[model samples]
Target: MSDVLVAVETVSRAKQLKAATGALHEALDARMMGADLFSSRDRYALFLAMQRRLHAGIAPLYGEPALAALVPDLPGRAKLVEIDRDFADIGATPPADEPVFVDPKDVPAALGWLYVAEGSSLGAAFLLKAAEALGLSVEHGARHLAAHPEGRGLHWRRFTQALDAVELTEAEEARAEAAAVVAFRRVSRIAEETLAGA
Candidate 1:
């Protein structure tokens, strides 16, 4: 591990993940933006499709038995159903291509992927507003961006608590950080591909 990763491991896992992945998160967010994403229904649908693709990639992680033991609410957090509602509202269908996949081999890697997925909910407030600017809403569209049923802050707090409770060795921590970076990169790639073709 690098000095930065070593330093991050001293903090709570959630904080370590946020610090370690901040640059990639910002880079991917920048790359994911385009006028069409918030301007037109067609483009917005493409954006939602990209989101679905990214979620699908990590869906399997939520089902891992070891991870389930750590975070029992994991399986219920998938955004696919909500994304489907958004797609329906926009009258768009998912692309025909096979979905991208991100396989995390162990508990540490799974936690890394879950860190990205769960952390995303914290930013959904802004996305909900953006979707509203496109005339989408929690009831009619943009369900995926709707505030979590438990409230975003509370939901995130619970998830982070679970994350911090897990014990990992130095090498495992490094693997977790790498998994998070990979997750962000995969989402960025999906966004780039979707937007380029849009």
Candidate 2:
């Protein structure tokens, strides 16, 4: 079990989409920040690829129970709900269908919410992993999305912590590294190949 996927195994395969997507996003954001500060596009692109790979990888989970829970069964409501919330929280609205990074100027703002969403997913997966490690399970019932609190709070907390660690001092930021980045890439690749083989 590759670490990337392993981190999310406690989550139902259906919910894996959310976890994977979130992990990939965090990896990307971390990479970007790392690159921006270190002046290393190599590092930036590495994380960027991770983010893209994760997005591509999680495409299958659109109908997974966990994801579906957040989205309404009605057409066009599920994905849009998050987008709406993001806009509402940020007090800025981009077109519903605008590309996420088409305009480089919006990168910072886009990344803010992207990181939050992704961080939440990462946190939830971390919680799920911890529970499983302790021999527990999350029974996400039908309508779980309704019951599942938004992960934004948890994600933002982690996000701010990361930012603080990095911004405070070089030594402090080193402590905040994503120990899981390399592991995630390895696992994600294996999972991709396995899925392709299947």
What TM-score against the true fold does each predicted structure earn? 0.88, 0.25
Model 2 lDDT on a 0 to 1 scale = 0.34
Question: Per-residue lDDT for 106 in model 1?
Answer: 81
Q: Rate the local accuracy (lDDT) of all candidates.
A: 0.81, 0.34
Summing lDDT over every window of 10 consecutive residues in candidate 1, give the lowest-scoring window.
Answer: 96-105
Q: Candidate 2, clashing residue pairs?
A: 71-78
The reply for model 2, stretches above 4 Å from the true place, is 1-38, 63-67, 70-151, 154-198
In order, what is each prediction's RMSD in angstroms?
5.2, 19.6
lDDT of 1 at 9: 35
Q: List candidate 1 segments past 4 Å from native.
A: 1-10, 34-36, 97-100
* Candidate number with greatest lDDT: 1
